[model samples]
Structures are given as C-alpha cells and as structure tokens.
Target: MSEMQSTRRGRPGYDQQGILAVAVAAFNEHGYDATSIGMLAERLGLSKSAIYHHFGSKDQILDLALDAALSGLEAVVDDPLPASAVEASAVARLEHVLRGAVHVLIAQLPAVTLLLRVRGNTEVERRALTRRRAFDRRITALVSEAQAEGALRADMDASVVARLTFGMINSIVEWYRPGGREGADRLADDVVAIALDGLRRR
Candidate 1:
C-alpha cells in the first residue's frame, strides 16, 4: 500500500519539500491550528488529496514543518563551544553562541518564531518546547560558569540571567526587519554590550 494521504485531495508526485515549505509559510502566517490543508493545497496549486498523499494528517504536516523550523537550532545545540575554557572564556563563548543564534533565528524567523511560540497543546509543540528548554539550560550553565570566573555579575541567578538574555534576543523577532535601520551585527553588538557591560561612564 502507498503512504497515507493527509487530506481528501490525493497527492502531488514531485516536490514534497516544496509543499512543506509552503505549508511552513502558511502555518507561520495563520498559526498551526488556524491553517488548513485546503489552504496549503490552494497555495501550492495542488489538490487537498495531493497534500494528503504527502502527509498523513495536518499534524503530520506540522511535525515536518516544525522540524524544518528547528533544523538550525539543532545545529547550534550540537556544536561544541571553543574547547579549552581559557581560550573560550565562558562569557566570550556565550556571546559567540548568542551571535550565531541571532543569525540562525533571523535566517529562519518563521520556523524560529513557531518554535518559540509552542505552548505544549500537542506532542509536536511539547517536543519543541523541550528542545528550547534544553538550549536554555545550556546557556544557563554558561552563565553560571561565567559568573564563577568573575566575567558576569554573580548577584543574579544564572537561570534568571539566562532568561533575561534570551528575552532580549528573542524580542528581535518582534521588531527586527531584514534591512531596517539596525543590522544584525550591530544589533548583536548592542545587545552584548548592554547585557554583559554596564552603561556607567568609565
């Protein structure tokens, strides 16, 4: 038997990846629950059954779309930071990861946004959240190490500091435009300075 179809429309033989790409865009614009296979089919100029041919259900489509969104993040999480602690100062390493994260997040904004917005209402959403939390935990450990090394303030808890840092970076999704007044590098610089250094005139 052939693979299960997601909708009544059947399937499109070529470009399942293309179909998923369109689906991700639609899911981003309308939200996963709000979007439908019909909309995806219409957008792709395929029949609903065609979409079903590729995916077994709307949730299956979401799973694939979420996978696409999270692909970048997975790489970041997997890559080891600069090996020696001294060569890769905790703070410096954290900054490097954060900068890379900004690039990845911006480059994959739709998927990253979806990853950030997951609320655990479904299995896929819950898994995305778990992965996000894992990344956060890694950052938190870096912050704690930085604090121990006297690179960051020890007053605030590492977890709290990590959340604050992510809050600052994640907010970029709301206001950052691809070619706006502030570029990604400049924004990353400003963010690092504000987060790692104080504004007091020295």
Candidate 2:
C-alpha cells in the first residue's frame, strides 16, 4: 500500500507527530511515570494498538518527547554565532544563547516542561539529565569567559550565575502563555535585559 493508505490502515488520521504531541501533554499533566499507553490511547480516542502503531512503548514516547525538548536546547547551544556576530564579545554571545533558549522554551513549552520534571527514573530520563548537565556546563563556561573578559562580575561563581540565569529562564514554563500580552520577542528582550543587566559589570 502507498504511504497514505498505510497511514490510514495504521491509525486512521493520527500520525506519530500528532500522537507524540498528545502523549507529551499527558506526560506533563499526569507525570511520565503515571502516564500509560492505555491512558494515551484514551486521550487520543484510539485503541492501545493504534497508539502502538506509531510508538512501540510509552518509554519510546517519553524518549521522543524528551528529545524534542533537549534537541532544541542543544541546537541553541551548538549553533554558531552569525557572521556579523563572529567578533562579538563573550557576553554578547552569551546573550544570544539566552535569547535562543527562551525562544526554544516558548516554542516547545510542553516538551520543555516535561523535561524539567524528569527525575532520571528511566534510561531515557537519565540520558536527558546527562545532556542537560552538559548544557549547563556550557553556559557556565560562557559565563566564566565573560567574567574573564571583564564583561560580567568576577566575584560571583560562573556555575552560580549559570544556575540562577537558567533558573529564571526555566521558570518561564510556569506562567508563559503563548498568546498573552508578551510576545516571544518581547519576552526574549525582557529576559536578556533582566539577566544581562544583573550580570554585566558596572
């Protein structure tokens, strides 16, 4: 059968992406450990078999959902500065990463929220936590570099700065509604302003 026909045969109109989206929302609502295939199937209005048609197990779904959040963050960290920003200061590069992180968190709010809630109970959660630590290290390194360059304060620990900075950013998931008075750009601007204002050396 053709791809379209195969999709219909497998799960009617629901594809992996749609299924994953619903699954992630449920994961966020009920906790990953509490969410089961049966619950997901009920949420999707499909049978367990139909849910399995897209994903092999609920763990696989959790893996994918965590990846959705981690990949966006990894991309923000890995992406090189624009050509025009090649000569930018360490603080400037740090600011860019912060803005990118806010954008990612806003765009992938559900996945990010789920990621933040993981406690390494499963292999997938452990792996995500490892990647998250690596991301945090990169931020700390950047903060250190900025401090070394006399851009940010020298007295404060870089790791502390990184944690506190991300503490602010990660907290966005709690109250950041998409279509609220504050748009992503405005939020990014405000985050950068608030964060960098405190970090920037006098």
lDDT of 1 at 3: 39
Model 2 lDDT, full chain set: 0.89
Q: Which window of 10 residues has the lowest lDDT sum in candidate 1? A: 1-10
Tell me the number of clashing residue pairs for each predicted model.
10, 0
Tens digit of per-residue lDDT, candidate 2, span 1-202: 4333336446455788888888999888888778889988888788999878778889999999899899999999888899988888989889999999999999999999999998999898999999999999999999999999999989999999999999999999999998999988999998899887854667
Model 2 scores worst on lDDT over the 10 consecutive residues at: 2-11
Per-model root-mean-square deviation over C-alphas: 5.6, 3.5
Rate residue 65 of model 2 by lDDT: 89
lDDT (10s digit) by residue, model 1, range 93-159? 8888778777777787766777777789998788877877887898899899999999888999999
| lDDT values for all models | 0.78, 0.89
lDDT of 2 at 101: 97
Q: Who wins the lDDT comparison?
A: 2
Give each model a TM-score.
0.83, 0.92
